[model samples]
Structures are given as structure tokens and as C-alpha cells.
Target: MSRVSRDGGQVLPFYAAMMACLLFAALAFVAVGMAGATRSDAQGAADAAALAAAREVRDNAFKGTDLLILTPEEWEEIIRGRRFHTAGACAQANAFAGTNDATAECAFDVPEFTVSVTTNGTVGDSVIPGTENMHARARATALIEPRCFLQPATTPPPPGGGGVVGIECRDGTVIIVNPSDPGPLYKLARKLFVVRLTD
Candidate 1:
């Protein structure tokens, strides 16, 4: 009877220890899942924010921002072939991140138009005792790529059948005047850039 009582006491303690371990494991798993969810949310916010900023740059620059007036060489020196508004692009990033419950840590200052951001809120429900304050962050990139390639006609069009460089042939072929022609190419080149997300 004494043995049984002693063994019973031991069993209860051991069982309680096992239960405690299992509970801790479950909590840890939940915390990890919450962290992952927060990370993905941050990444989504970053992606949206970057795209917004890139689009802002694209739309504004293509439509003849003050920067466009500068010579291509000067523009390249300033923005590395991609022109964007620093303040306006950051504003767009902020707006996008705000909608996603995140905050932009930096503006679109990279030469290639990249941005980084962090979640505004923590993974509040992280059950782990030490990780409740952890924040998630992410980065994203966007591009304003040229959609059109201007190629000068190799051969003259049929007599009286052709016009200027803007005209396109029936076979999807188009004539591109000399870049230095000092005519339509300069005015129309800006239209070629199409906004896209590179990464």
C-alpha cells in the first residue's frame, strides 16, 4: 500500500511535467505561426508600397515632370536613367503601407527604385513570453521599363507609301528616325516606359 501511494505521487508529478512541456510546445508553435503571418503581411505591404512609388515615378515622369526637361545625360546623372519624385514617391509608399497596417522605414532612394518597410503593429497574440514585441520587416523593388524599342527603317518605304517615324508597317514593323534627328523621337521616347514590379 505504501509503494502504491508513493508511485501514485510520482506519477502525478511526472504527468504534470509532461503536460507542462506539451503546453509550452503548443504555445511556441502558435507564436511561430503568428510571426510568420506577420512577416508575410509586412512583405505584402512592402510590395504594394514599392509598386505605388514606382508607378508614381512612372506616371509623373512620363507625363513631363520638371525633370524631363533636363537633357538625358543630366537626367541619367541625377536618377540613373529612372526619374522619380522623392517626396511624392515616399508619400505613395506611406499611403500604401498605411492601408496595410505597416510603415515605410525609407523612401524610394535606391538607384533602381527599391523600398523597405516594417509592420506598424506587433504580432500581438504571440503567446511566447519573450517574442511579443517582435516586429516584421520586408523589402521590395519596382521598375519603370521601356516598353518600346525604336528601330530605324533599314530600307525606304514604297514610293509615296511611307510617312514619318511614328508610322508602323502592316507587318508590326515600325520605322524609328535617327535618335539625333531632333524631331519626334525626343518627345515620344518618354511614352515607351511601362511601370512594372521587378522584385
Candidate 2:
């Protein structure tokens, strides 16, 4: 009976140790899950900011030829103002904006992002050459930082894995001349745009 009691005592410690290990493992799993959730939420916030910035740029460009006339400094100021206003407003609306890490808050959790505009003014060649005009092109790019824990799981297996998201618009005037040729001379423009996202 003494031997049996000693063995039983040893078994109790072993069982207690095993339970502790299991508890630790469970806590670890919960931690990882919460991290993933936070990452996903951050990414969503970034996406929203990026899209809003792009749209603002596009809408402003569509207003007229101001993009063509503005000096480099003026253009930069305009772009920055538009970008920050849009981003700030959107970020303020989102719950995650100011709570994250310092770096993330500074960038609105978008580590790398871009906004660009291109304008082209040209004279058309036509039967009545004097009746030609100008054209303009504009584009915007916004790069968002990927969420830490969620990217690996959600991103598709490679080849061309990652890309950007954007939007574009163009406006110009046209002139008609020559009854026979009926040359319609005007501005011709095109835009390539994208908007990136993760589920």
C-alpha cells in the first residue's frame, strides 16, 4: 500500500504538469488568432484610405486643365492637400486609425502609397490644320502596406501575386472642319488604373 501511494503521488505531479502545458498552448493559439484579426482590420483601413485618395485625385483632375497649368510646387501642394484631406477624413471615420503603432498611424497604416497625374497637350493634324486643340492625361496611384499576419494566408500562391488599385479620367475639346473630309480634330487621351484589395 505504501508503494502504491508513492506512485499515485508521482502521477499527480505529472498530470498537473501536462495540464499547465496544455493551458499555455491554448493561450498561445488565442494570441495568434487575435494578431491575425488585428492585421486584417488594419489592412481594411488602409484599403479604404487608398481608394478614397485615388478618387479624390481623379475627380480633381476631371475638373479642368488646372493640372496642366499648375507649377510643380503648386501641383505638389494641390496633390498633397487632396491626398491628406481625403486620407484624414477616411481615417478619422475608421476605428483603427490612431490606435495602432506610431509608424502605422503616421502613414494611416499605409506604409507605401503614390498619387500621380499626367497631362498631354497636342495639336491635331487635319485638312484644316488651324482648327486643332489640346489634350490632357491624369493618373493616381496609392500603395497600401500589407497586414502583418493575414497576407501570407490570404495571398494566392505566387507568379504575379501582388498589384495596385487605381482610377482615371480624361476631358478635351473637339473641332469639326472640311465638309468632304469632315475632320474632327480634338484631344485624345487614355488612362490605365487599378485598385488593390485583400479579403
Candidate 3:
């Protein structure tokens, strides 16, 4: 009976230790999963902020431009993602991040807008120390790519000045723009530029 009791006591300690290790591992996994979820949320916010900033620039680039005075070269530049200002674009990034429960810092480099975001909420309570006060951060970049270029008339100029321009697009679509009218140019500008996120 004494021998049997000794063996049982030894087995009980081993089983208890195994259970403790399993509990610790499960808690660790929970903590890791929480942190991953927070990181994913932060990344989503960053993507939204960056895309908003880029689209803001794309949609407002020709606000004050006089399309009638634009030369073919200038039109080419516009289609190449130039002639746009970064003013008010970061505000858009901030607003988008806020909508996702985050804060954003935006940087503009010509056709690209980079946004870094931090989640407003922490990872909450976890088995990992210091995670309760930790917030997830992520970065994303969005690019404004010009999809159309000015295709000047191949024919000779007429006695009267030409009032219409031809724009050739990447998708094999040609758009005719009357420089005297701002409506078509503005609408065409939106189609000429495309905003997308980068990994």
C-alpha cells in the first residue's frame, strides 16, 4: 500500500505540472491572438488613411487650373500625376483614420502618399506584461497613377484654333475634352488618375 501511494503521488505532481504548462500556453496564445487582431486593425486603418489622402489629391488637383491655356505638354504632366498639391490631403488621412478608431501621420511624395497609423485602443488585458497599455501601429502607402495621356491631333491645324483635345487612356478608351468647358476636364481628370494601395 505504501508503494502504491508513493507512485500515485508522483503521477499526480506530473499531471498537475502538465496542466499548468498547458494553461500557460493557452493564455500565451490568447495574448498573441489579441495582439494580432489589434495589428490587423491598425493596418486596415493605415490603408484607408493612405488611400483617402491619395484620392483627395487626385480629385482636387485641377481645381483652379485654366484648362484652355494648357499645352499638350502640360496635359501630359497632369496625366503623369504631377501638378497636384499636398495641401489638405493629410487632413483627409486624419479623418479616415479617425473613422477607423485610429490616428494617422501622412507623408506625401509626388504620386505617393504614405500613412502611418496607431490604434486608439490598446490590446486590452492579456497574459503578456505591458500589453494592456500597448497600442498597435501599421503603415501603408497609396499611389496615384495616371491612366491617360494627351493624344494630339495627327492632322494639320485649321485656320481657326482647335477647341477640343483627344486623350488616350490605358484601357484603349479615348476621351474628347473641350478646353472651354471645365465640366468635362474635371470629370476626365478623375478618370485619368487612379488611386490604389500598395503592400
Best by lDDT: 3
Name the best candidate (by TM-score): 3
How accurate locally, in lDDT, is each candidate? 0.64, 0.34, 0.85
Q: Which stretch of 10 consecutive residues in model 1 shows the poorest summed lDDT?
A: 156-165
Please give, for residues 69-143, the per-residue lDDT of candidate 1 as tens digits.
Answer: 344343333223354445577788889999999989554544346778889888776557656677899998877
In model 2, the runs with Cα more than 4 Å from the true position are: 64-199
My TM-score estimates for the predictions, one after another, are 0.68, 0.40, 0.90
Candidate 1 local distance difference test against the native: 0.64
Model 3 C-alpha lDDT per residue in residues 1-199, reported as the tens digit of each score: 6999999999999999999999999999999999999999999999999999998888887877777677666677777877997788999999999999999999888798999999999998977899999999999999999888777563212333466777788999987776665474546768898889877
Candidate order (TM-score): 3, 1, 2
The candidate with the higher TM-score, 1 or 3, is 3
Q: lDDT winner between 2 and 3, please give it.
A: 3
Which residue pairs come into collision in candidate 1? Answer: none
**Candidate 3 ranges with C-alpha deviation above 4 Å:** 154-162, 182-186
Question: How accurate locally is residue 86 in candidate 1, as Cα lDDT from 0 to 100?
Answer: 50
Which RMSD values do the candidates have, in order?
7.2, 25.0, 2.6
